[model samples]
Target: MPRGGIGRHGLRPPPRRFRCVTAGRDYRDVARTQWWRAAAGAWLLGMTLEYIRYRIAEPDRAEFEAACARAAVPLASAPQCRAYELSHCEEEPGSYILRIDWTSTEDHLKGFRASDAFHAFVAEVRPYVRDIEEMRHYAPTRVAGAGAGAAEDTAPNLYEWAGGAEAWERLTEAFYREVHRDDLLEPLFRHMDAHHPHYVALWLAEVFGGPEHYTEERGGFQRMADRHLGKGITEQQRRRWISLLMDAADEVGLPADPEFRSAFTGYIEWGTRLAVANSRPGAGAAGWAPVPKWGWGVAPPRRS
Candidate 1:
């Protein structure tokens, strides 16, 4: 409503909020804000942040970004590098900041500096060393998080990502439509129950971090394994099943993020491979095992 009073979040400045107006500036107020920030920074006690400010010409921006992308490979693999981000300045297009979080200042200087990953990282970014204006480590303060953020699910489970039971139902329904037409897999399910797809969907939902209805009402892994017994699943058919299911996933609009898709495919491969093995004569399928709840990158325990 008034000029010069609005803050970053579009709210009127609070008495406790930090401000930089020379007209009514109080040196004590500034000192109090710094004191509060340092005291609250306990959230990131041991971690050290290194902000590297770069002033690159407009022409060099593309090459600089590409170099940083290449350099990220080593940072991702390095033990001492906790996290990193290369950010662009909105107000000044020529300005960029590369922020990296290290496990500790000691670990970064003494540990990562001596590692092979650091050497590889340096080779990618050495050309821009002269363009850097600031490169130093600072500790994080309790002053974390942001406002007006997008609605992102921070839950670490695949079930939520797959959109629960209804999503699974859609997936199986679409998949069976393909299986019904494909000659390779059609004959295998020709004599199957009408509710086979529904049950299979339940199994999938339960396995990938959904509810335990498959285990609760329809029976668990043993029942599932027994269904495949003596079906004589072949490698060609197994691969075909995977293809149809993946196509169905696309058709049904499953989450296509790399992490989600990779984890989903990992489970599919595991189940299908085991199904092929268990369908063969006298194969010892696992029984009485607890139903697995798959997450971001977790896999079931090895059978052997």
Candidate 2:
């Protein structure tokens, strides 16, 4: 029999009412589950952290460390706080990184904003930083090298791959403590520490040269040299800082594999420019600006 809305087969049209009811149930279930999942996620957003990196001027490390220790303890034990630490960089002397982890972002905000002790600490340590360029906030996404259910490292490597990022953080902290002590680089940079001139020198030398590949090292080194053009940073200080970095890299098990070394060589070469540049500002960043001509003494080395 021929139907009004069907072909010769005479099948009935699909039931709109039945389809609507099924879809509505499914949509409601999905919406409800999504809402619950979001709520659960917010509850589990427990680990909030801030990584504050700085370069304190020379001669102020002891004073700054003591002030921070005195003022930081009260804020450290806040109900919302899980951990707090202050660390220096070994590879790059005079640089510091402070890591603070909170139970929740809300708790962290409350602790800093509401507490007088935290403010006191900030006031005490504020003068020490030449610049606090970056403060990054992070939440843990995954824990590497652990079993499906496990949160711990089963077999840690020198770099602590088994432990993951946590291990890296610990390695950096430990590396600094070993190298940047009274024994080395301290006597050399003492007067220049916390000085704006030194700050700008580093900004140009290490920070700028890494990726920019300044055609002449002068651009970067001049900053450091100009600051201490008269006082002078001895060649020994430069060499010591490099050695400290190398030792720290070794301790952290940063692979000295050929590939890594090749890359690092580039970094060192560029860094050398900054060092040389600042040593002689009269010429340029590299104190003695190399005037480009076709083969002055010997042919210039080819750029990689």
Candidate 2 lDDT for residue 32: 25
**In angstroms, what RMSD does candidate 1 have relative to the true structure?**
16.5
lDDT, candidates in the order shown: 0.68, 0.43
Model 1: clashing residue pairs? Answer: 40-142, 41-141, 41-142
The TM-score values for the models, in the order shown, are: 0.48, 0.33
Q: Which ten contiguous residues of candidate 2 have the minimum total lDDT?
A: 290-299
Best model number under lDDT = 1
Model 2, 131-201: lDDT tens per residue?
68678766543221112332111322222221334433444454445544747666655554433332332
Superposition TM-score, candidate 2 onto the true structure: 0.33
Instruction: State model 1's lDDT.
Output: 0.68
Per-residue CA lDDT of model 1 for 140-192, tens digit only, reads: 43233223331112444577677888999999999998898999999999987
Indicate the TM-score of model 1.
Answer: 0.48
